[model samples]
Target: MAIEVNGKTIETDEEGYLINLAEWNEDIAKILAAEDELSITDNHWEVIKFLRDYYDEYQIAPAVRVLTKAIGKKLGPEKGNSKYLYELFPYGPAKQACRYAGLPKPTGCV
Candidate 1:
């Protein structure tokens, strides 16, 4: 499938994750978040940016447990737990946030 962001048509997979990670930008994230009914906030950007950095370092998407711990270590404990993450991405933090961050569907995510 495809989504229009900033007048550009971006491609996505069946589940809505971006097909071309290079095509990703903040505007793409905004479009994806809007489609998911989420209003992007600074808090959301924190996790998304973190995910992008983590991916650049590891070339892989971390699962929920790893994501939470990594986030705790990097972003502060207050923003690390499942509750806070869930509040931002009700669908599943690792899955949804990675999608918004323009990463692939995390391994082991159903």
Candidate 2:
């Protein structure tokens, strides 16, 4: 599948993750979040940016458990827990946030 962002046709997987990580941008992220019925706020951007940075360093998308722990370390405990993360990305923090960050589906996510 594909999504149009800023007049460019960007490709995505059937599940909506970007086909080319290089094609990701803020506009595309907004579109992806809209598809999931989410409105990106500063709090949401924090998670998305964090996910992107994590993928950059690790070369992998983290699962929910790993994501929570890492987030707690980097962002703090209050923002790192499942409840807080879920409040930001209700579909599933690692999966949904990674999608918005234009990373692949987190390993082990169904």
Candidate 3:
């Protein structure tokens, strides 16, 4: 599938995740959150941005433990802890956030 943002086309997998992870951005994230029927908020944006940067640097989705740790280090304990992350993405932060970020399901998520 393909998602269009500002007249530019971006490709996605059968499941709707972006095929070229590099194509992701805040606008893409917004489009994806809309697809999932979610209203983007600061909290949601926080995770999405973090996940994108994490992917860019690590080349892999951070598992829950790594996610929490990285988030804690960067955003402080309030936003970084499991309770907060779970509240934002009950399906698991890496999985659910990746879905909204237009990225594929992380390896080892299941």
Candidate 4:
């Protein structure tokens, strides 16, 4: 599938994750979020940015448990738990957030 962004067509997978990670930018992210019916807020950006950084360093999308632990360590405990993350990405934090961040589906996610 493909999405039109600023007059350019960007590809995505059947599940809606970006086909080319390098094609991602803030505008693309906003479109992806809107597709998911989510309005990007500062808090959403925080998690999205964090996921991008993690993917950059690790070359992989983290699973939910690992995401929670890593987020706790870096972003603090209050924002690290499943409850908080779920509030931010109710579909599944790692999966949905990575999608917004233009990464592949996280391993172990159904």
Q: Model 1 off-target regions past 4 Å? A: none
lDDT of 2 at 97: 91
- How well does candidate 2 match the true structure in TM-score terms? 0.97
Query: What residue runs in model 2 are displaced by over 4 Å at the alpha carbon?
Result: none
RMSD of each: 0.7, 0.7, 2.0, 0.7
Candidates by lDDT, descending order = 1, 4, 2, 3
RMSD of 4: 0.7
For model 2, residues 36-86, the per-residue Cα lDDT tens digits are: 788899999998999999999999999999999999999899998999999
Q: For each predicted model, how many residue pairs clash, with residues at least 3 apart or on different chains?
A: 0, 0, 0, 0
By lDDT, is 1 or 2 better?
Answer: 1
lDDT of each: 0.94, 0.93, 0.83, 0.94
Clash count, candidate 4: 0
Per-prediction TM-score, please?
0.97, 0.97, 0.81, 0.97
In candidate 4, stretches whose alpha carbon ends up further than 4 angstroms from where it belongs are: none
Q: Taking the tens digit of each residue's C-alpha lDDT, what string does model 1 give over 1-110?
A: 99998788999999999998999999999989998888999999999999999999999999999999999998899988999999999999999999999999999999
Residue pairs in steric clash, candidate 1? Answer: none
True-vs-predicted CA distance for residue 57, candidate 2, Å:
0.7
Q: Model 4, residue 100: displacement in angstroms?
A: 0.6
The better-scoring model by lDDT among 1 and 3 is 1
